[model samples]
Target: MEFAFDEADAAFRRDLVDFLDRELADGWERSEFGLGSAVHTDFSRKFVRTLAGRGWLTPHWPERYGGGGQGAWQHFVLGEEMWKRGEPRGPQYMNVNWVGPSLIKYGTEEQKRTLLPPIARGEVFWCQGFSEPEAGTDLAALRTRAVRDGDGYLLNGQKIWTSYADGADHCFLLARTGTVADGRRGISVFLLPLDTPGVEVRPIDGFVGDHSFNEVFLKDVWVPRSRLLGEENKGWDIVRRTLAYERVGAPRYARAALVLDGLADWSRTRGLLHDPGVQEQFGEARALCEAARLLVYRVIDERAKDKEPSPRANQARAAMVQAERAVGDLALDVMGSEALAEGSRGDAQFRNSLGAGIAAGSYEVQLNLITRLILKLPKE
Candidate 1:
């Protein structure tokens, strides 16, 4: 259980730090930018292109796919730095993380040729069509259906709480290709164009922020057979693998730690650092953040070693949510009314905390997984 970074890793981290400092010099804070805001998304488009140009984007991907062919740790380092700065790459992070990797693994040759380059070049935006009005954590219950047509599928369903759907060029969509009773076995993944006929995106304003979520309606939308990712009706395997990557992708602990630093700075500046409660809260949040960082590192370590995925990913994700919520709570407690104002650091942390628990599967779901899979506990 060696935890120290080797020289090469340390050098890479230093270079990444320099790159981020140069790129985000204009007061970039992770919490200040909303996920769906035009300012953030637009900046992300350009910023990720820059990363691609510098060969920083998709570094962990195979070199044949326009990546640097670096290891998983490098990719994790990039994610941490980007997340620490509020993920300047925007939605493109999905491209580099699960989507592109899934495509590389499961896509047909032609599909990979057409899709992988643009993602590697940071030229596209993709939204996930996973959650629905009725099916969230219980994704097997999703009702979105893609009935087989002559040479394609006619998709008719609605996806709710879809992030970046309004601006995304494509959707990593899931639809039932079998009978409803088939449940998880019935699902398939589609690389559907968002602008296909009968597709509609309606914005939903929620606690996170404007443009953070959308309701995507597909009324008899059609997709060609070529767009199907992996084997038809066997997408459950693809989805499970994708979710495994997504569970710990963002390095949320990095952002939480940054928020803790900001809170400490604020406390010191306001002559409140001497307060015993504030110090104690900061210590607790800091400890949680470190715990989360180490837990996520363990998951990454497993990936680097080519080990089988385990419930430890669930543990890491759960720790990250806990750290985020702790920091959010600390921000509100320390800042009080000032934290309530929109766009403030405290407000952003609070919103992030709220969303962290819900996004990428709920905290409760993670606990259930840990109990069943890790603890080997019997269900009542």
Candidate 2:
């Protein structure tokens, strides 16, 4: 297949690169804190609004929703550039990538009117309430409940590993609206306002860093029936499809490749590029990054063609995790003791690589999907 970008896409990339260079010429170092950091989030709020002003924040969404009506490839191109520059858009990436689109597809007309504009304007932050203390990975087993109460639901439960919850305005939350034995069939999605009464967000200190993860608790939080997304007891289908887009949403391999370039520059400056083992490792890491990029592009190509979401997305996500880990390892090998320094490129890469495998879905879970779907293997 041809890999060359047409003139318009090439021009778009050039313009986007120029825009990033101009906007991030100073103080962009704050983004190195990684997504969900107070530093990163603060910078992103302003940066995303700037992008929205330029009509680039949600370019793929329809024009009626305040977007530019661009295609998926344009959005993917934007993501690649942002991720390569360490994703200065912060949590707003989710707002454009899957959250707003999911709302467009499943939200009520009134909900769409109320919510989509803020996201398109880059005026809000949203956190996903997916993982629970006991229900991570195996999401269908989640126990967070939303009981019927008059015309609304009373939500009560806890969600862990919730990124960006500390400063979020709303949550794309999932809860069990039916019995536990109903598995995936029991779940529903809620567009929960974080400031609602009885809602609490507690920061969790972890390896990824402070403000990156939190535990969100709900105690008799009242949510109007109008807040429910899609249909009750039918959220699993929406989650599945949303995860498909999300799997390749971040263009993580783009960041991995950029990190690899930095590692190479570091090696060359230290005259370590001449080492045979170091050279070999560099070659392998570069190969993995390129492989991951191509795999992701394949998934994006399918989306551009409007093909059904395929197991190829799972394969692409798995490759991205491997690519990130490989580059992270290479940084440690090249940087030696300096790699341990906080905020160092190697140190940041290592932290990001650790989260890459676990976020969205675990690497092991992606392998299970590839085996069962791509390889057509029977379950044990």
Q: Which structure among the candidates has the greatest TM-score?
A: 2
Residue-pair clashes per candidate, as listed? Answer: 1, 0
lDDT of each: 0.90, 0.90
Q: Candidate 2 lDDT, tens digit per residue, 24-107?
A: 856354235577677778889999999999999999999998899988889999999999888899999888888998998899
TM-score of each: 0.96, 0.97
Worst 10 residues of 2 by lDDT: 25-34
Scanning candidate 1 in windows of ten residues, the lowest lDDT window is: 25-34
lDDT per residue (tens digit) for residues 39-158 in model 1 = 898899899899999999999999999999999999998999888888898889887899999999999999999999999999999989999989998999999999999899999999
* Residue-pair clash count for candidate 1: 1
Judged by whole-model lDDT over C-alpha atoms, candidate 2 comes out at 0.90
Colliding residue pairs in candidate 1:
30-86
Mark the regions of model 2 whose C-alpha exceeds 4 Å error after superposition. 26-32, 208-210
RMSD per candidate (Å) reads 1.5, 1.4
The parts of candidate 1 lying over 4 Å away from their true place are: 30-32
